[model samples]
Target: MRVVIAGGHGKIALLLARSLTSAGDEVAALIRNPEHAADVRAAGAEPILFDVENTATDRLLAVVTGSDAVVFAAGAGQGSGVARKYTVDSGGSVRLAEAAEQVGTQRFLQISTMGAGQPPARGSDKVWAAYIDAKTQAENDLRARNLNWTILRPGRLIDTAGTGLVTLAPPPVGRGDVPRADVAAVLTALLPAAHTFGMTVELVSGSTPISQAIAQLSD
Candidate 1:
């Protein structure tokens, strides 16, 4: 399978790319920084320089065309301010979905956060609130599109090594921490799963193996 990942340089994205490429699948990562090209390439993915925040949809279309799937992993990142939360998180996700629709790439996987659809609590930090709101809009927008979309909302992400085990279920899966590598493992399993279409699931560390967890989704 050929996959296109937005935010290619991200921790999860790089892990996913390496796993996919090692399995003999083709992977192209959309990266904004030219300097990140070597890192993406080292992970065994072809890095396409495209900024999801500043680029046009038509341009994204060219990059997404002919790919088997598109993964929306882009984020505004820490200290980027509130406005960018909407532009990069929500807006970038929608742009990828639009391009995927136009090119007939039916499989679209989005990496979201656990609190996406829920409103922020009273007196929450403005940026945190905006991030959640942006993700909520992204999820809503993807649901409205004519595409096979799966949103994976992982809990507090840690950089620890993956355990290859997780609890995958629709909300409320409750709060917990998950290794970023484990989330990438789950995405690799879900990429070609037709049964996962239209599903919104949450992830965190647990006993079930990654493949078994995904398979159980259909059972």
Candidate 2:
């Protein structure tokens, strides 16, 4: 399969690209920084320099055209301010979805976060609130589209090595930390799952192996 990943330079995106390529699938990663090209290429993906935040929808459409699937992994980054949360996380996702819809791309996997639609806790900083709000909007927008979309909301992300085991279920899967590698593993597993269409799942470390966890979701 050929897949296009927005924010191709992200940790999860890079891991995912490598995993897919190792499996003999083609990956095109959209990145804004020209300097990140070598890194993305090193991960076995063709790097397409496109900034989801400022690029036109038609331009994005060109990038997504003829792709089997699209994954939205772009973000405003840790040091970015509140406004960017909306522009990059929420707006970028909408732009990609519009392009996917126009091109008749059927499969879209959105990388979201836990607590996306829930009310922000008291004492939460403005940026944290904005991040959650942005993800919420993105999830809502994807759900409203006619595409075959699956939203994976993973719990607090850690950089530890993946265990290949996880708890995947429709929400209130509760709070926990999951390795970025494990999250990538789950995303890879979800690509060909027809039963995951329209499903929104939360992931965190647990006993079930990745394949078994995914199969249980279908069951």
Query: Among these predicted structures, which one has the highest lDDT?
Result: 2
Question: 1-219 in candidate 2: lDDT tens per residue?
Answer: 999999999999999999999999999999999999999999999999998988877788888999999999999999999999999999999999989999999999999999998988988999999999999999999999999999999999999999999999999898999999999999999999999999999999999999999999877
Clashing pairs in 1: none
lDDT of 1 by residue, 144-189 (tens): 9999999999999999999998999988998999999999999999
The RMSD of every model to the true structure, in order and in angstroms, is: 0.7, 0.6
lDDT minimum window of 10 residues, candidate 1: 53-62
Model 2 accuracy (lDDT, Cα)? 0.96
User: How accurate locally is residue 41 in candidate 1, as Cα lDDT from 0 to 100?
Assistant: 94
